[model samples]
Target: MIEILKPTELPLARETGALVAGILQTLKARSVVGTNLLDIDRQAQAMIAEAGALSCYVDYAPSFGRGPFGHYICTSVNDAVLHGLPFDYELADGDLLSLDLAVSLGGIVADSAISFVVGDSPQPESVALIDATERALRAAIAAAGPGVHIGDLSHAIGKVLNAAGYEVNTEFGGHGVGSTMHQDPHVSNIGRPGRGYRLRPGLLLALEPWVMADTAKLVTDADGWTLRSATGCRTSHSEHTIAITDDGAEIMTLPKG
Candidate 1:
């Protein structure tokens, strides 16, 4: 469902968004070389519990995934892009890692994701892939406002990714998030403007723009969760929870510090 949150709830949404951002930032900072993916998940669990927030992923059993996620956060490495279930794997220098998180605080939910290099030795392709997703996310946010069509945001994001020489996968993209983690009004990475739902004030959307280094095709890992590039090429993903306003859009998932 497409939900336009009440003004009173915007503050709660902001709080949830900030919490999600802070957790991802903390995880990223501590994810140095030799850090295990399972350790990262444990840290996320502790932080969520300390913050008095509920994890949207732990009990999540969507059609695309097998059973409950049983994890607090998603840890995508290198070629892994979406629904990356945390496992027992140590991060190495120059590894591209993406952390996606969603949490509920004050009865409101917010979601976001970030991609960064694990260590000092960053690959040129990895840096470029991360940069493209970040740029696309920013463009999508800038295009969101009351009366603007969802397609406009998609177009803006698509232009950036396509120009960067990467293809987008529409199977999974951004979606509405408020009372629940995933809602209606699916926002694809690419589309034609002037189509789809019109943006409205108080509408919260998790605008994510992810791209693979080469092909758009995805292959699900044996874990039945992590989505990797068909050609095993590296990938990157960037996302933020934004609230549409009368004037424009306000990004709620930015790290305060």
Candidate 2:
């Protein structure tokens, strides 16, 4: 379903977005070597509860995933890319971890994701992958505003990832968000400009660009939720939720001080 926020609803969306961003930032800071994925999930659960927010992940059972996600956050490590279910695994130095989070507060929802290297061993390839996704995300956001086509945002994002030499996957990409976590106006990572849904004020979109080092193919983990690169190559993902306005897109998920 596509949802457009009322002017009055935008403030709640911003509050929800900030809460999501702050929790993800905190999780990233604590994801050190030897930190277990379950611990990270617990931290997210605690924070969400303290903030009086509801997790969009735990109990989330979409058609694409196995029943009930049963976790507070997604913990993707190294080869893992999207929808990574938290498990009983300890992280290691040099591991590339991606944390994707979404939450609802005051009846509005916001979503975002970040990928980074754990510990001190930041590999060049890992850094490059993360940078490419981040740049793509920025470009996409810059292209978003009232009357802009969804394809324009997709094209902007695709240019960065493609130039970075990584293949783009369209199976899973950005989408609309509002009262619920996911919604209409599916935003692919790559596309032709001047095509697809037209943007409008009060609309919220979650723009994410992710890529695997070598291939566009993905494999599902035994857990039935984690998506990993077919070649086991490192991967990265970056995302943010933004609200379209008359001036331009207003980023909702910024870390709160």
lDDT, candidate 1, 18-97, per-residue tens: 89999999999999999999999999999999999999999999998985999999999999999999999999999999
Per-model lDDT: 0.95, 0.94
Per-model C-alpha RMSD = 0.6, 0.7
lDDT of 2 by residue, 201-232 (tens): 99999999999999999999888899999999
Candidate 2, superposed: residue stretches over 4 Å from native: none
The local distance difference test score of model 1 is 0.95
Clashes of 1: 0
Compute each candidate's TM-score over C-alphas.
Answer: 0.99, 0.99
